[model samples]
Target chain A: MRAPLAERVGNYLLLIVFGLFALGPIVTILVAALGPDDGGSGSSGFGNFGKAWEIGHFGSYLRTSVAVSVSVVVVSVLLSVLSGYAFGTMRFRGAGVLFYLFLVGIMMPTEAIIVPLYFDLRTLGLTDTFWAIALPQVAQSVAFGTFWMRAYFRSSSRSLVEAARLDGAGPWRTLWQVLVPPARPALVTLIVLVFMWTWNEFLIPLVMVTSESLRTAPLGLAFFSGQYTSGFTLLAAGAVIVGTPVVLVYAFLQRHFIAGMLEGAVRE
Target chain B: MSSPPGEPRKVGYLYILPALLVYGAFLLYPLVRAVHLSLFEWNGITLGKFVGLSNYADVVADAGLRAAFGHALVLIVFYSVLPVVIGLALASVLQRAKVRGLGFFRTVVFLPQVIAMVVVAVSWRHIYAPDGPLNDVLRAVGLDSVARGWLGDYTFALPAVGVIGTWFETGLVTVLLLAGMARIPRERYEAARLDGAGAFAEFFAVVLPAVRGEIAVAVTLTVIAALRTFDLVYVTTSGGPGTSTSVPSYEVYHRAFELGQVGSAAAIGVCLTVLIFVITLGVNRLADRSTA
Candidate 1:
């Protein structure tokens, strides 16, 4: 049923207000990025993007971000699927304890672990390396992904698993050939979230990497802004450069993103 | 779904072993080590003497540390309280009036969440500059006296930082509430209307009770965000303007890396963790009680 015209106008007005509030800063930065560099060196329009890319050394940073995000997503998604499948389908000894251990990883904040983690990794001569940045995030993502995919697995079709087993399919065959195809939505959600977290992670890369070449996009953007404090146009362009990849992925997969978030809220 | 023929009861352990090992080494081990290190007085490079909770004592007695925790509490207002209220109001309005382009609106609002916090900080830092758009607008409207460098002002730095949190979080909370509100069966809204319920009354009788779970989730998430806020604070103010914006997480980094106070940093980290747990549990319990 439609509301009265007065109420409808109010609704539209409120929505516009909120929409502007959310998109204003983003648009402001984008606009500034297109403007001429404040230092009178870089060209106007999209030329600023190229200038920022070179000056900020975003090529190297983006490469590292891609490497870290891809590695984390691949490893964590695989691990989460295996563990979630086991937990959702099996009843084994110590399952509860092991799952709760993962839960602690999920709930434990990174600040609490980073100090000792740095010291530990340093002792092992792993600090300032790719593994130091990627591995911890892999573990962190798996902790959440296991919980998410387990919920999907738990509510999945039991008859399908039974049917696969009756057909002489082993656990591996059942998971890959029978169940995973139907679990595409859940997997997509997990992939998107893990990728976003790994890409946007600033703290781990900040604390772990001292090498300029190993810096991720967000860390590079931070340092660039710090050094080029006077060049607003370049800084805005750098911000856009760092932010665009995830935004593109999000725009394409927004359904999975929103669904995963709402599902998390409902589960809570 | 019974075990396959000849399958052992412990076969599940094989699948979980790799994940469990990594998680234990990277997350769990470090957490326990943080706890242990919190109990000692060490510069993180030498043999440590046991302090036996004196670090915890410093967490209590140290004025700067006390103020950092207090700043986190203050941030909860802008981060959690304000956003939840705004979300509920927005969701309730939209629930009462079915608006077109709802999808477009939701997508636009949720965009900030996808951006990196460092980028968000940079954009807002430009906006909050002394001669920035905010001050420019203020001068244009003859409110010039109200304008200042928001993140640099001693009085306004924390609130300026908090407002950024508000901007970042409202979208998540609103989207969650909207999803929750949408699930209320139309028949219930009609039933409330049939009982002579106005918008406020209908919301109180129906929409409010229905979305308690989402509200709880939003609160929990935002409170956690506020407490664990390091990226935004680091990039924006770096706890500047004379520790006015210093938070526990920022302290966790600065004390350990800059000040060589590894013991105190660990102690602060442990305290922050305990605070998160207690507050999360409290919110969940309150949500449970209200819903029940």
Candidate 2:
């Protein structure tokens, strides 16, 4: 049954008002990015974007973002898939205890460990390098990714695994051939999520590295806003430049990403 | 979950070794080292004498640390409590409204969840600027006396920062609650109306209890956001206006990086993690009780 017209109107009004509150700042940035600012972008043009692009050296930062995210995803996902398969399909000694240990990863906030991790990386001489950021993030992502894929694999039909094994497929072959093809949704969702988190990571970069050239996009964006304080158009342009990559990814994979997030939250 | 004909193979440890090694080296080892460092008086570089819990003493005694923890809890009021309340209200309204363009509204609302925190902070910094739209709107409505540098005002800065957290969290909580509410049968709402239940009664008696697990999920997520917030606070105020907004995460960064006081930072970090663990455990236990 449908709601009464009065109630329907009230709900839309409420949603639209809150939607404005949610999206108002982004719209503010959008307008400022496109509009004019004194002594920047001349007048009524998008040269602010060009100027922000150059001033922030966003090109280099974007490259760093891509490199770090790609490495983290590849390394984390490979490790997670292997571990997830084992946890899903096989029973080892201390299996329950070990899985609980991995779940600890979810509870430990990045802030709690990053302070000491900075020193550890410096001792290992990995500070100011990509590995410093990527490695810890890879661990974090794999913790979640392993939990995610393990659920997927556990719920898969055992008959499929048995059939593949009966046809002489080893465990590795069964995983590659029988399980993974059907798990593409979970895999893609994990990739998109890990990519977003790693690309958008700021604190690890802020603490771990001081080199300007090696800064990730979000870190570069913060510094750019700090330096270009008087240039609102440029600041707005810088924001869009930094945030647009993840927004694009979200727009493209909205459904899978939302499903994954909700599932993760519900599980927690 | 299935009972196998033979005993379960223990060789699966070999398959998980690579992951466990990475987890141990990067996560577990760092955690252990953080605890170890917390007991000493060393800076980041040098080997130093053990202080034996004095750094933790500093964390307990310091006024600055207390304020940081207080600010984070205040943020929980905004980031978790207010959002959850608002989410429940929204879900109650939307669950029966049969609205068109539901997906579009959901996207617009959830858009903030995906944006970079640095970007969110920067965008909000503009909104709270002295000459920003907020002030302009205040002036237009003839309430110009109240407008100030929100992120700079001592009384308003922490709440100003909390508002941003609230803004980001509301959509997420609302969507989560709505997802849970979707499972409630429509006829239940009709039955409530047949018994002369008004909106408030219908909601509290039916919608709210049905979504207990979701309320727990929302609380857990948002409380964690409040407790562990770093990037947003970093870019916005830098824990400024005389440390009115210094969260534990910010303090950890400031101590370890700026002051190079490694031990106390580790101590505070450990304390913060324990607090989060306790709160989350309590939340889950309470949630499980309600659901069961």
Candidate 3:
């Protein structure tokens, strides 16, 4: 059906306005990052990126961020896949209660638990260790990840599971040979989403790891801005450095990224 | 030909054990301890006398805490309501028109969601600076009197920061709405059009009702994001300018680590958790009932 001419014009105009509103901050930041900087003058050129790199120690921060995010993603995904299979396909006593407990983990916010988490970590003498950040995040990730993978498994065709079982395949063998391959899309989606979330997470690292050397990229950026409060250009440059990779990922994997988010949102 | 169901069931229990143990150690233990701590007074290194109900009392009585919650509500307006409205409107438009460069437009809009919040916060802090682009535009338009320190001034700081939250979030909401729109069967709209419905009428009659679940999901997520408004505030304001932009999460941070009021901080955390849980449950129930 053809839209009326007036409606078409109005829709295009609305889209343009919304597009600009969405893009305005990013464009403004890019321009500001490029502008010349004095104590109060406007920022200019690529100089700020260099200055930000040097001043923020962005190189070291980026390395730490990459290491932490990758580790979290790998560990979280592996554990989630194992547990998701169990929860989804297999029947067990107490499974319903155990799953409900995991659901409770979903509602518990970081703020609600972080104070005690801090004390817990402190007691274990792992306050500033990478594990302090990674372990809790992995736990949090498992709650959602297992849920995600379970949904994927439940929705998966039962014929394959039955066929594998008929071929004398055990639960573990079927999961490895039959289920895992078909579940790859969901698993990939989970990995990317988890990586993006863990990489961008701030509060966990801020509270759990006080050592400057152990700071993730987001924490480092916060500290960098605080330490160099007056340097807008440097801040903008640092922002770009930290923000670009995820933006690039979203650009490329727009479909998967979006599907992952929607699945998480609508599933539970 | 079925195997005994009980054998596989036993294996399933064993399979879930590792995840359950990890969850028990990290999430459940900490949450229980947090609730327990909220009932007493203790600094990290020292155990003080029991202060039952006083921590809760302090959270309620504190002027700053009240202001912070108010600020969080303001953020909901900016972050949750505004984004949903704008995103829904845009989704409506995109659904109606065959726009050029649709994919590019979608990608650009959704870019902010993938970017770190700290980066977005820092970038916007510059934009809100006294001599930044915002003030520059204000001056250029002969509205010099209106321009002030956006992040530094107490009056504008909270709202200014809240607007950044809006900017960061609108894209994700748009994508979610768009996905919902995509799922709406085209035949329903065709049927509506055949019945002589206008664009607005068809939207209300068909598209809106179908996407109710997505809208609920969007609102729930956005509200939680608004309530947990910390990263941007931390990076940009640090609850400064007389704590104008402090939210509960930020206050919890300050109390727990900065002031060493671990027990009180735990109380605040508990309050925040309960508040969020109740609100989300209410929202979900309302959404379920309305849609049902």
Candidate 4:
């Protein structure tokens, strides 16, 4: 049946409003990045980008962020995938209780535990290092990641696992050879989601690492803005530098990202 | 699907061991320590006397913390209500028509979600500066009288920052609502159209009911985020203009890290967690009942 003209117009108008609302801040930032420096002295050019790159010392910051984020994603996905296979495919005593215990981590926001985590890291002598940031994030990310992978695992056919078992495949070999291959899409989805989250994370890194040398991109942006108080163009340039990778990743993988988020949210 | 029998159970425990150990060390242990620390008055570096509920009393008595929490509640309107309404409306629209470049539109809408909050805050801070783009636009459009320092002013700062939260979070809400909308069978819409339902009527009767689950999920997540708002406030105003824009998280950060009042910080953190639990439980229960 053909919809009425008024409805179509109204729908289009609604979409346009939301589209502008979502895109407005980003466009504003992009313009600011390309606009003249805050003093209104220099003409608009790529000058801010060069200054940001030089003064912000973003080279080291970029490396630290990439290392930390990649480490967290790789560790988180591996742990979640293994745990998910066990929980989703195996019959185990106390499995239900253990899985529910993992869910508790999700309910407890990182902010709640960050205070003691600082002290704990200090005692362990791991403070001011990449492990301090990477370890906690991996732990936190694993809760959601495991939950996601578990859902993916549970939805797959049990007959496959049974078939693997009958074919003389041990549990590890079965998971490695059979279950892991089928779970590739879900694994990719989790990796991208976790990568994006860890990349954009700020508070944990800010609280954990006090050394300037160890700052992540988000922390670097915070520090850069503070140091370049009057240099709005440079700050904008820094934001772009920090925000660009995730934006680029999302541009290419929007569907997978959205699907992953929806899957994570809808399950409970 | 129940787990089979005996052998795999051993493997399951081993599989979860690493995650369990890490969570215990980092997440669970710290939480317990935070609670323990809430009972003492100590700087982060040095141990002090046990205060035993005095810190909680201080948090309760402090006007600054209370005001910060009040501001956080105000933020809930921006973070939870505004984006949710906009997202639902947008999702409703997208559901009705297949716009050209819909995928591109979705990408643009979801862009802010990928950007860090610090970047979003800095960007908005510049826009809200006294002589920034917002005021420039206002002046150019002949509305020069209305222009002001959006983040620097006492009256406008919190809402201004809250609006950024709305802007940043609306896309997630939109995506969730869209996913929910997708689950609504087309037959229901067809039936509504055949019954001479107008767009509004059909939306109210068909789409709204179907996406109730999505709405619940969005509100719950957004409310949690609103309560925990810190990065934007930290980057923009640092809860400045006499703490007008301070939220609980910023207050906790300040109390613990900046002032060396670890106990009070933990108290605030504990209180914030309780508040979140209450609010989330209430929302989730309502959502559960509706979907049930």
Name every residue pair that clashes in candidate 4: A91-B3, A92-B9
DockQ value of candidate 4: 0.63
Model 3 TM: 0.94
Candidate 3: lDDT of B282?
81
- TM-score result, candidate 1: 0.97
Candidate 4 error regions (>4 Å): A1-10, A36-44, B1-8, B193-196
**Candidate 2, after superposition: displacement of residue A108 in Å?**
0.9
Retained native contacts per candidate, as fractions?
0.75, 0.74, 0.74, 0.70
Candidate 2 lDDT, B37-150, residue by residue in tens = 999887777777799989988877898888888998999999999999998888778777768877887777888888999999999999999998889899899999998989
Provide the overall lDDT of each model, using Cα atoms, as 2-decimal numbers: 0.90, 0.86, 0.83, 0.83
- Give the per-prediction TM-score of chain B: 0.95, 0.95, 0.93, 0.93
Higher-scoring candidate on DockQ, 1 or 3: 1
lDDT of 3 by residue, B1-292 (tens): 1221223567787777777777788889999999889888887788666888888998879888888888889999998999999888888778768666777778878777788889888778778889888899999999999998898997889889889878878988888888789888879988998999997898899988988888888888888889898888888888979888889999889988989888888998898888877877888788799987
Q: Write the per-residue lDDT of candidate 1 for residues B94-120, one digit (tens) a residue.
A: 866778898988898888888999999
Which lDDT value does model 2 have at B236?
90
Error of 3 at B204 (Å): 2.8
Candidate 1 stretches greater than 4 Å from native: A265-268, B1-8
- For candidate 1, give the docking quality class from DockQ: medium
**Deviation (Å) of B139 in candidate 3:** 0.3
DockQ of each: 0.63, 0.68, 0.59, 0.63
Model 3 clashing residue pairs (backbone) = A34-A44, A34-A45, A35-A43, A35-A44, A36-A42, A36-A43, A36-A44
* Candidate 3 local lDDT, A157-185, one digit each (tens): 78888998899998889988999997878
